[model samples]
Target: MSGRSVKKGKRPQNSGNVLAVETKTTTTAQNNVKFCLNHMQSGFSVEDLSKEARAEFAMALFKRRGMTWTEIQQAPKHGLGSEKMPASSIRAAIPRVFGDVENFLVLRYSGLLPMAGVRVGDVYHIVWLEPQFGDLYDHG
Candidate 1:
């Protein structure tokens, strides 16, 4: 793997298009996302999810070290699998950065809602998750 490779979503292994995004903000520990307490009341404790699923979340968020915001996947807001809110509203909570809209992106995992974030220079900060989904965050 050489610590850097873009596994395109053509194979069955990547059916969900599990993406590894990055940010300049260094995490003290690997695979630990600062969940938004405001939008969420409570969800599965990272410890509670299956080892495989937890690993998936971690791998999906491994940080696309050098990938640009445009290179990574961005959830769409109109037609087919559209989110409840418009893209602008989803990005509204996040303040301006570097005067570029291409810097921010939203990604949906196997959970109920999608996560909103921004890519500032070399940093991609996951600001929050959409607050519309039910409390429980599970694929099934």
Candidate 2:
């Protein structure tokens, strides 16, 4: 058989594998971009929240639910300036922003405490607290 005849019968080998690998890489990158965008939109973070700011946040929790001072104190402390708060308390107090009370109640009943507020490693908290409640006295 002639070389031209042999070449005409066989398909190009690299084209199919190259297309498959490119498709996979493109999909992975797209997924990564989507993940980053979602994280940015969530607006949850823990950095730059001062002790006083956290206290103010806790105070807001108290006001929303009319929680007594003692109840406020009893609120779970993830530590000073920490962003973690009991999800039950948050759900009960600020269900509009968090979620339905029923869900939180179920979590509590199951002994699976959910946490809210800014997590220590979160970046959104840093931006939110500074401009809004940087001064404790500003909280109503």
Candidate 3:
């Protein structure tokens, strides 16, 4: 027999055919504006949001403010030139904008724990939750 051993039909690890799933949820455009308005009205910050909720909330705030992607990338509040804000800070600020339930679910699904300085893009999107319209969804 030859010195070389023949390989089986099994595919190699980390092959291109192996798909890795990356899921992201976002809020609606109208809801985003409302959330941002709420955040600004209530003075929310990154610290007020949950881990998964931060990215979406941040996107909403930027959208409400009419900020471009480049503007967001170079924004001063993002700590582009200063000390980064903690993830905990962002988490803490989420409720002030999106409220409690949405933020909690977002964080739970995203599998992120409380911490400092988490990247904004790794968490959520701007279309995850439906916008609340007055008492339409409210049972009370």
Best by TM-score: 1
Supply every candidate's count of residue pairs whose N, Cα or C atoms clash at under 3 angstroms: 6, 4, 25
TM-score of 1: 0.34
User: How are the candidates ranked when ordered by lDDT, highest leading?
Assistant: 1, 3, 2
Best by lDDT: 1
**lDDT tens per residue, model 1, 1-140:** 57888877775443454435444575433333333323321233344445665665455555434333444433243211223223344323344442345433445543545554543444445555444444322323
Model 2 lDDT tens row, 21-45: 4443333212211001122112222
Give the residue spans of candidate 3 off by over 4 A.
Answer: 1-35, 39-67, 75-84, 90-140
lDDT of each: 0.41, 0.28, 0.31
TM-score for each candidate, following the candidate numbering: 0.34, 0.19, 0.20
Off by over 4 Å in 2: 1-46, 67-127, 130-140
Alpha-carbon deviation at 48 in model 1, angstroms: 11
